[model samples]
Target: MKVDPGTLDWKDAYKLLIGSVLPRPIAFVSTVDRDGHCNLAPFSFFTGICANPMMVCFAPMIRGTDGKKKDTLSNIEATKQFVINIVGEKIAAKMNDCAIEYPPEVDEFVQTGLTKIPCEFVKPPRVKECDVHLECTLHEIVTFGDHPGAGSLVIGRVVYLHVLDELFENGKINSEKLRPIGRMAGQTYTRAVSDTFELERKKQPGK
Candidate 1:
């Protein structure tokens, strides 16, 4: 079936995109306004960009109904700091609770009953429930689409990282211990630690 994104409505196209992108790693972002109002939210349009300078990026889209930017985006824009908390299966329910469209003054950490830990470099606090926290400074924000549901890709440079001591094994993070949760389409989620498999990469013949 051939589907043209231009022809489809925004909602339909969004659904298709989310459904096809299987098991996307969720970034439970935390930020604070100038008055120190805390905001917590989850975004699946997130990934690591580079290791040389330690960079990460997450795309937060505008509301389709009102075309306004999310609180996280606004805070990051104002303060130029934010924290990306990696979501785990243990706090998945609380993380989901943050998906609500609360007013800007609302404190999601208090609403969801999640503990917030002070970050070293950023003004925003990190979710204590999440095992890993990436303290970041805003590098850039690239916007796409002018209408409602438009997206702004927020690029941040990781300044500090806090990882649970037990989740670390040898030199790497143990997936079994991390037990990260992934996002799917329409309220669906995936357990990244389950049914895992490993495949060795093959070397090129010329090499």
Candidate 2:
């Protein structure tokens, strides 16, 4: 179907985007409020930006119900710190449990029965259940719009990383051991370790 995104409402556009995206890597982000209350949530609109500065980004769209920023975004804004916990099949359900729209004072770690480990360089804690964690310092937050469903892109620089030794093979991570989970349309998820394939990039002419 040929659809003009500009002609569609934000909700419809979002629906189309999510439905067609197939599967997206989820960023299970944890942040701390000014009072030290820890918040955890999952965002599918997340990706790595660059390797040199070790930057990553995620989009925290405005809450659909209230048209306001999410508690995660608020906490990141205040604390200037967040940890992107890699979601694996083992903790996928627990991560989903934290996705509920809890209040600012709510500690998702307690609510979801997840353990919070102290971060090395950030105020926010990391999920001990996660095999990999990227402790980040807030680099910037760029807002797209003021209306509902609008998103704020949060860019952060990785200050520290924690990875399970078993998940690392040689100089690269073992995807099969990691068994990462990804987001699908609606209440569905996909596993990265299942049905995998590889392709070598084409080489250019040597000088």
Candidate 3:
């Protein structure tokens, strides 16, 4: 069935998008507000954007319930820094716990019992349980709209990186060791490195 997004309700559009997107990588982002209160949340609409300067981006949609910015977005806007912790199967449940809509004053680390370790260049702390962490400074925020379900693409440039030594080998991360988890529609999640396949890139003819 074909449907025009322009004619669809926002909630319906959201449902369609999430359902069709397959499994998306989860960005377990941590940030600190102006008062140094820490906030952690997960965003499934997240991905790597560029490699030259090492950049990534995530979309923190406006809260449908209150039509306001999420605490994560607000903290990022206030501090201009954040840490994106890669979600692994080990910490998946704790990561899920952080998805709850907690008050701005709530420290998710304390709420979820996740360890918060200080970053090298950013104020936001990293999740000690996460195998990899990307410490970034804000590159830009591109807002799609002001209404509920609207997304603000927060582009960040990675300034510091922390990776578990066991997961890195030969200049590449060991997928099996990382055991990353991803977000599916609704209350579902996926194991990203499970049931994998490999395909070599085809070289151009007469190159």
Candidate 4:
């Protein structure tokens, strides 16, 4: 069925976007407030936008209860830095706790009982339990749309990477070791280790 996206209402259109997007990676972002309190949140609308310079992005939509931007986004904007912690099956509980709509002053590290290890490059602390943590600086904040649901796309340039010693294989970290988890529509989540496949690009005629 053909549909004109421009004509569709916001709620309907948003539903289509989320459902159709399939399983998107969760960015358990950690940013520090002006008071040095840590704020953590999981955003499914997150992805690695580049590799050459190592960049990632996520948009934390405005909170529906207040029609205002969440604390995570605010902290990132103020500090111009954040830690992107990879979500895995083991950290699911803590990650969920961090997603709560806590007040700006609330420290997610304390609420979730997650260890906050000092970041080597950024001010924000990294989730010590996460298999992978990326220390990134704000690359840009592209403001788009107008409604409350509208958001500023936060682009961060990853300058440092923290990998668990056990997850490292050769120069890379194995997916199985990471046990990464992704987000689905609604309250559903998926574990990568449960599903995977191998692929190879077609060979070109010229060497």
The best candidate by lDDT is 3
lDDT (Cα, tens digit) per residue for candidate 1, span 19-128: 89877999999999999999999999999999979999999998887888889999999999999999989999999999899999999999999998899988899998
**Residue ranges of candidate 4 with Cα displaced over 4 Å:** none
Rank ordering of all candidates by TM-score, starting from the highest: 3, 1, 2, 4
Score candidate 3 by lDDT. Answer: 0.93
Candidate 2 per-residue lDDT, tens place, 1-207, comes to 899997899899999999998689999999988998889999999999998899999999999989889999999999899999999999988888898998899999999889988989998888999999999999999999978868999999999999999988787888888899888888989988788898998778793
Ranking by lDDT: 3, 1, 2, 4
Q: Each prediction's Cα lDDT score?
A: 0.92, 0.92, 0.93, 0.88
lDDT of 2 at 122: 91
lDDT of 1 at 202: 100
lDDT, candidate 4, 47-149, per-residue tens: 8887999989998887766778889888988899999999989989889888889999888889988998999989999988898999999999887764665
Worst 10 residues of 2 by lDDT: 198-207
- Model 4 residue 151 distance off true place after TM-score fit, in angstroms: 1.3
**Could you report the Cα RMSD, in angstroms, for every candidate shown?**
1.0, 1.2, 0.8, 1.4
TM-score of each: 0.97, 0.96, 0.98, 0.94
| The 10-residue segment with the lowest total lDDT in model 1 | 143-152
lDDT of 3 by residue, 36-99 (tens): 9999999999999888899999999999989999999999999999999999999988998998
Question: Which regions of candidate 1 deviate over 4 angstroms?
Answer: none
Cα deviation of 9 in candidate 4 (Å)? Answer: 3.5
Alpha-carbon error at 109 in model 1, in Å? 0.5
